[model samples]
Target: MSSAPLSPVALFWRCCLWLILLLALPAQAQFTLGQRATDQAATPHVQARLVVQAPDGIAAGQPLTLGLLLTHQPQWHTYWKNAGDSGLPTELDWDVPPGLEAGEIAWPVPQQIRVGDLLNYGYEGQILLPVPMTVGPDFTPDADGTVRIGLHARWLVCRVECIPEDVQLQVQLPVAQSHGAFAAAFADAQARAPAVSSALTGQFEVAPDGQHVTLQVQGLPAPAQGQELAFYPEAADTFRHAAVLGRDWQQRWDGAVWHATLPLSDMRGATPAALEVVLGLPVAGSSVAEQPPAAAWRIAAPVQGQWQAAQLAEISPALAAALAANQANQTNPTTTAPPASGGSNARSGSWLMALAGGLIGGLLLNLMPCVFPVLAIKLLGFARHGSDMRAQRLGGLAYTLGTVVSFAALGALLLALRAAGEQLGWGFQLQNPMVIVALAVLFTVLGLNLAGVFEFGQMLPSGIASLHLRHPVADAFLSGVLAVAVASPCTAPFMGASLGFAVALPAAQALAIFAALGLGMALPYLLLSWAPGLLRWLPRPGPWMATFRCAMAFPMLATVVWLTWVLGQQTGVDGVAALLALLLALSALIWALTLQGRTRWLLGAVLAALLGWLLPTLAPYLRELPPQEASAASSAPGTALWQPWSPEQQTQLLAEGRPVFVDYTAAWCVTCQFNKRTTLSDPAVLQAFTLRGVQLLRADWTRQDPRITAALEQLGRSGVPVYVLLAPGKAPVVLTELIRPDDVLQALAGI
Candidate 1:
């Protein structure tokens, strides 16, 4: 300032000298590793902070603790040392003055988080990583009596996507002779750090084939009364965590203690000396039911199964002895594991029980509405045979063959569909709209035949009748077929359990069960044929037989009407119209067959052609319409109080602490209708439901619904009239197939 400013040439020379000196400075100096506190962006998802976290002054030879804290956005996580299926663990490069020693990081227990199909081990939210350092006499304190450390860190933060991050952090601390300000915080961090558990001392070793690691612990007690155990591995890429734990996916829990075999992965490069895992045990606590006390263990797993030699690396001798003593106190000598999947895992029904149940159920079908039409045919034929045991037995045998073959075929189709991954069950054939429509058409024709529209046995030429649809054998066979078709939807007493067991069994076993059911249905008729005395109960065939036969046609027509309505339910109004039109066209052709000569043949051909063309068009249109409102959904003043059932609604009612009574019904199930009219709709039953505050839910499988199918599976059932009573926080009580008034009342009283 005293002299004049320098000339341009002199200024340029001075600037060049200053630039040279700046360039000569060390890179560390440029990085400035002397700051007391610093914040750096580790990644887009994470922010890192390095703090001295030390006492105001440090003793020359005393140990000091610091923290490398990382705060991440929600859902973003940083990997643990061994990052399961993927990701890299965070690492730090420390540059400090001479004579300063740094210890290994004390890692906290990491959580197992699954991403898509892969499992990852990492920490979410904020974590303060504790780093211990010791000062030696050779370590020089700065002129300001400060201690400094230069830290370079690399980490990865991930959510659905990952981001790599690095930070050059410098932290400076003042030398102090006393303890640190955050001594309690440091101690807490140390406590949270993972250490080998002595709670249950057990050996961990690889399988003999080296394909898996087996962890067998005999001393670990059941977590508390209502608690379960959780397993977590500590090493990175060492095990197939996701594939090994939970699901029916190779995990098995034995009763004595937990024995799990974890399949090894080839991704882990080398075999480490030890394996680390964490076990979460249930302990009593005031909060919730109990607190889960999680402990980590470092196990010395050798190359092979010298299980007794490997010990828990972090346990004390006293704790190990306590675990051994606890295990010895139990009386159970062996362990038992639960069965695998729901398919074959369930206990199977005994063959004798299934056979007996099917027989009884089939016999009961005679009393049901659907079987009434067939019953009329059977009784008429019985009178026609009149005490001739030999003739009756032959007819009975033919009928039995037809019935058994149909049942066998149904069973075969069920097994085939199951193998093809279709989630169908008993009565699954009815779930298809085409099957429903076809059944309707067949019933319609059967009704017309009963009404005398066309006589197969009486009117057809004897040559044609003997080998085709008109022979006595054909008549008996058709009668049996009709019986089976009508009887299928009605799942009688004990039938649900037996059929459920049968469907889950092998194809041959399942078919045998179906055959038994057919035999049961035919038993009464077969007995009447074999023993002549039973026919004496009825009057001899006479003029009254014709009147009775005509009268029986009404029931067949009644069934046809019901089928028409069912068709409407399945395919709206147009489907019903199409079916009725087809019936009319077919009837005209059959009527033409009764007329004389060429005229009859020509008229019949025209009608047949019309039907052949019309049937194809109808078949194409047999699509399932949208589900309509169920009668149960509405609580109109004159109607009984009930609600439409769904899996969600059933679950919701149960969760609300309201007792629920579910009626798994279908329109095609005649027994279900009978029960609704006689028992469920009775005043006493209604009063019981009202008194018990029962939420009545009706699941109508009149049409296809996968939810209903799934629900049936849960109940171990395959057909309808399955009445389940659910009480608040209690196991469901399944009532008998036939819902009598007293059954409902008694079930409600128990609830």
Candidate 2:
């Protein structure tokens, strides 16, 4: 009894402790070593608050001051805009009345604060940030002769782990005949603010080849010795983990303005939108009030270069050919360097890697749950003929060859379609309702066979079954066909790269890779057959064999179910029903083949063949009921926000300044669904998103959605469950397909 009570208490304390720690964590970053934020309230840290100087409202031409006040509890502090290495700088969002113009933040030069080995520039005790604003020439005063301004401010306050905060503020002040009581204090603060020259400007241009970024700055002072140059992006998403690469300071034609070329290194891509580049100096005789134009500058315009090592070779040969033809069509084209041959290695490497990748991919494909039942059927057949090692070996080899040929045929067909301008990929076949229906019927028939509703040996016209099974070449061909059918849903990890390469590579290389994959898949079964001793472990054929065979039908039935669902998604309920009817008909045809005599079998085969040929042809004309779409929890089913996948959504989200979380997922993908259930669906992560007002956009590829496919291509991913988060004013960070709760939280926080 005592222990039981103690257990609950312990559990409660554990939960409370975890919640406290989680809540205490800095949203923008992890608590790293030697990092600490200043404590204000009895903790020697300061609290940063955002406030504006508007009372009710103000008139045009009224000099307005916006203040970001940092109230230290006592002795603690916070950093300025250029928080050296690992501290937060103050930034704000201001919205004023129409015709009102505002200048940049008048940041006061801050003290150099040292915490461990990191150098941070900030304020301690207490500090106030001021911004000057005024109305346009054509302006009117309100009835109360006042103006109101709204501001959204973000700043990093440190005590241990830098804690970032977002605060909303609105202040109203009357248009006065004289200065208010706090006006002089604000003026004194303004005098201490850094003086950033209005003429100073910086422009960034990345090399076309993407190897370097050159920052061109105008009207900037020469740096003093030992002055460390730094840049803060006005936009947070511009770069990550950036450092100065190279700086070249030269005098521009404009008097006294130096053109400084600062090269950035280890940029890791774009800078975060939250920051602006601030070039700091250790020059003597500069006060906190005199650090503006000479101290910090905003990037006049942001620039990014397109240079991915992997993408250099993805240049379309078709595009190149088109360009060449256009040039040749002209009467006199300017001479240019011969087309570089560097692409040859890229093409060849892609092809060989694709082949090798396909082989490895095939081996992994064997592990998919979707393909397991079909393989089991093949192995069971082998077990039945354990004594005939040669027959087993031949059957296995034949299967491998069959798979290879089928893959080659499929690859050739896909390439042909591509040449004809059909946008497609490896799994594109599954998008056709007729194909889905056909596959469904075929599997159902196989299921019926395994269920033992018919005896093929007795019903056949004596010689046919013997001829079909006995001929090694025919067996091998059939095995190949079966392997291709079973390998569809099982996309191994490397298959994406291989398939993408195959699509872009020469026809012969693509075919070769496809064939290699088939061979790899079939290798295991062939080896098993070669080593007959492995079959000795199987139980002898009896009642149990019948039970096992029947049991195997369920997996096929499951496949049928999945195909039917896919059909519904692609076309509609009508399509699914049609598929179901066709499956029933197929079962009847198989049952007919099991009738006692050869005549019945022949007739059944004829009917089955005709139906098989005709149903697919008829599928196109069938009308389908639209599938039901998923909706957000609060939304009514029909009126929910379930938009089809589109690049437009991404653009719109960014434009609206709303944080977005995109889940690239599909219906037929089991792993994707599993991830959704176990990780994405976690309540803690969902609540965090909901509370933070993060928009959840799902791109469903359940059926082939072209836009979603294009998005996948953009990301260099060929499959579903690709997660991405775009935060307001932050660079988009991609999350792994297999998500973790902590990972989701961190990404959302970062954004």
Candidate 3:
């Protein structure tokens, strides 16, 4: 009947059209379902659907189970009832028939979801929230023998960033019969819901100072007696959700009763007459493949202490205005508590002070160990251009341009990310293991190049190589960029306060401060270029230049060593070994590329394969590596002079009337290491700390620690190498980033 046999292309097009039509049919059906009981709402991070438990239609005078199912994309989660430190719980507003009633959601045990410095209670993966719906005897079926249920549901989904989504969903179910597709899900939800405990009795007493709450419970189950139990409070702003739990001093089970002392939130809004809490215990044995379920018991304990209003810390007007403006601009702002600023001595002061501080800080940054290696390269560059005054001046300007532009760009990125709710600060790049590894590899190549292992220009095409030789300005500019990259990890004396204040400033002002910092760093080199008299002091370009260039390579190599050590601190010894292997392979590849003929090609291919293998091997380490616990030696445990730091621990120690000194440092920070090896390690300083009964705490920022970040913010600092001395009933003394033994001794004496 057809006119002719279709061509292959025509036949393919016909099949594609049919496939599109088939796919479009389901989409059309779904649009109709959007107005019915089986409606589903999908978003980038989550999918929501409504289901009924009864396979048959609703029966009069019987209660039926209804469920709102939420399936999250991997690593994304929706909040629970309390929402802990920073999230909003899911909500459902139902429009039911006059005779039908809906009960509260039977919530399942929530998982502790930690995001940066905040700890949230939430659900991940798939969860079914079951609600009991009573069908009254007076209820009647619609004209079509079906009941229509309408729901307006809203939820906030979050991974690292949060997005609020809502849907108006409706479903039509048969009056007498329903599909039992979701019966098992409803049953599972019921099983996971926390039961009201009858055996356990509890009472809570607030500390007189209003800093902590102690809960005492009698009659524990045998399985949960000594096992680690999680306590989730039903009310917000009662306890510090981010405080580290499970420590013996915090929570413990004695012979007859369990006792737990939890810190009170600094922003605790009110005192409740009774504290309702869910105490959850892990299942005796659970497979990881399945959802690790918990057995939870709800307790409503009577309060036993007087209530006091939380003391609000004073903040600078600029910071307050900035925070207010930022909050006002957000359509859906996070409810995470602001960083505690009670002890902060950070003063924004006038704009002039911030600019001056940034300038002086950048100038002093040249003297830091982090910048020393790059300065050596600059020294070599200066020597090479000594004879050509015009070229030298041009090179200086190019370098300055590069430095200022790089600083501005970095500052802008930092500000933008923070605005988007990233918990980041100065030198945040070095916190990433990938950045550290990249720096290590970069320094290795630079060292090899300087040592005459290979020439960069020689590796390029003839024209590009000639251009590279002619345009030394590009090299000078890149050198400036590299200097800023390395120098950023060190927060020079005045830099901490300036950078801390800059974060709260407007984008324009913040960027200006960053540019000022770069300009100050470049000033010395710019001066040397313009002042021919200063250039004359340097030895003329000669045979010594070759030796000096080679000597500079060692400093670069030293930088590589430091970078390697920093990576080790972040990802452990295996990461260090992997990095070293990759570096060796890369060096071999570079050397092979420089060779001639088939041998070069053959060796390069082999090394490239080696690199390809080594590259993927590092991915496992890159994913959130667990922070290593500071060892006894690290905390000076032998002499009992130093211990690891935590905000709760610091508060407890201070509450106990002990002076506390905190050393906020990181492995990547050169100045921190210098201080650790020098003044901080001095015997007299240690003796003074011990003699004065001062508790020493080391807040290691080797890994990206939100708690440490928050603590630093409290002290008005944005980087490591922050020293603070605290004594009861006295203001917290904010010590400088670089401290001397005398400074420590005097601070202790004053305390």
Candidate 4:
């Protein structure tokens, strides 16, 4: 009774010693079921055990609950029945004696887990899947009056990476009247199971395009009427489980009925007569304190619309092969891991090749039309700084820093968004109408500044203008940033492979490749600034400099026009009109700022008001516009030489043994337009296609389309201007980004 209190340090050590002792004991030793029925199995991340709801013993002709309880380590989880995007559900193979039977497992409501751009439904922490077991009237026990239940259990557990584990376990119980020891555990499991709802009625309709499904459900309880709810289809391949539910797909409640429009999977293989789904909601005022509780209901709704049978059957052969290989890898884990040394060597080689390609592609980007205007401005800056050697060198370094940093930042953002489950790729920014509007305004302002319409310095405060003039390096750096913004839409040769590889690489390696691209683009300018001889070759700053600077404005104006056209393609004529009005108001505002005193204030105020009115008017057009069908704007008027590209059409064409040529292009891509007008429209090329019976298809990427993105990835590309020639039973022949008529003919000839 008089024992002294231990110090904090001593107490901590005592607890640690006890923990070590407990860890050393066998997994099954801790459980005491009084020989009713219990056995345990364990892995590095999970502990599995079998428990029955009969404490004393099983009685003849009585129904009992048997549970396979899985306790996961922190953050690791196991899948549910459907398994969502990627996973296999836990499987149990029971070895029951004669005159004994077990019913299907009663699966509990599952939680949503996101991995990169994929969504999965599973359970974390401890879960009990209860199975109803029945003892027949004729059941006989062993001489010792004990009944043995054998089970082979297999499950996949995942935190960041998945590990498949299995174990064999047997539990022995005496034949006697029994009540469950784990009454509370069994009760909790039963409470979590979804009940079949008799009150709820629903129906689903597939859109005519076969891309979306609209679901309508009525007769919701008062508590869940307007609250957020999640839909989990009981069957797979009904919709794209990986797609972000509320964002990519949409859900809303209108007091009377819950409505949801979800995108269908590209590789959908199901054409069910009715869709079985579970609607889940968070349990309010839940009594279970150990874990979060959810209430769910199961409903089977009849399908009202036709399925896209023809399109569903036309999945590309290459994509089908890839999917098959992926499934094989999941099923056979032995083939997943290669020899460590050989794996490292192969990875290193592949990484180096990607890096090199990024570098070369960046160098080639300088020759693209999109980059020309910015480079022209840099050239003028160089000519102006010809006499100052030190300033020139510093400016060059600053420009290089800006380019590299910009590329790195963009790459990081892209990776982060992807990890958060967004489907995007290179030139993804241009897909947004808002970004297009911003770029159009920027190019317009730059054009005005270069044409000597109004000086930027004059518009700013005197002190700020002085500081900017003192440091011309800032201007050079910004020029480099502008160059990247414009150049991103163009996919130069070699860039496609490198960027595609970068998306699949580790974060550090992908960023290294991005930095390499920036460095390559900056190298020539850095050399020009460093070498005095090269600087001397340029005309000295004089009247000719003014004329050259004015001429550079034409390219900038042309770029604005091109951007306007691109915006038109994405939105419509209304969007183009809004953009033009905004630009006109912005030009007038700048011109007003150059005036003096009261006149400046008056005209500037009117123009500012006009701009304010126009901006809000343009907001509606910024939303996702419905995709327009192929029009004359993309190809020559009234000419059917090129059909809109679709996976189904391509499959059908290839099946007919006809060679198919797919042109993956986008409206914002300068090189794609150039090639379209020249090489693609050439009469000789047209005649060759006609004679050889080559089917031409154009895949427009002017807006975000996941199908097109997936197809481009299959071709080892992440951006547009991807030319692919496919011959039946032959490997797809990929052409260079910039193709000549001869290149097209040669590719066709091979096919």
Say which candidate scores most in TM-score. 3
Model 4 regions lying over 4 Å from their true place: 1-342, 622-626, 630-639, 655-658
Residue 247 in candidate 2, Cα distance off native in Å = 53
lDDT scores of the candidates, listed in order:
0.63, 0.56, 0.73, 0.73
Candidate 4, run of 10 with poorest lDDT: 26-35
lDDT accuracy of residue 669 in candidate 4: 81
Question: TM-scores for all candidates?
Answer: 0.51, 0.48, 0.65, 0.58
What's the lDDT for candidate 3?
0.73
Segments in model 3 whose C-alpha atoms lie over 4 Å from true places: 1-107, 110-190, 195-269, 273-349, 622-624, 631-640
- How far residue 535's Cα lies from its native spot in candidate 4, in Å, is 1.4
Which tens-of-lDDT digit does each residue in 634-662 have in candidate 1?
A: 21222447777876576556657889988
- By lDDT: ranked, best first: 4, 3, 1, 2
lDDT of 2 by residue, 289-315 (tens): 223223543445445444333222232
lDDT of 4 by residue, 1-751 (tens): 1122221112222323332432222122212211113478665577888888975467775667788999999999999888887778999889888768888889987888878877888889999988888888878887898888888788878877665666667888887858687788899888888778688999999988788988999887777788767778878666888665347788898777999888887657657799889887766654222233467778899988777643445556664554333222221211222213346775677678788888887898899887888888778778777689998898899889878878877888878887887667788899877678777877777777667777644664445435435556665676667667788777787787678778778999999988888888888999998988887779877789778877887999898998988888777777788778878987898899988899999999998877766565555544324333532244443247888787768876887789998888888887788788888889998899899998888887787766788887665467777787777765566677777899888867866
TM-score of 3: 0.65
User: Which whole-number lDDT from 0 to 100 does residue 676 have in model 3?
Assistant: 82
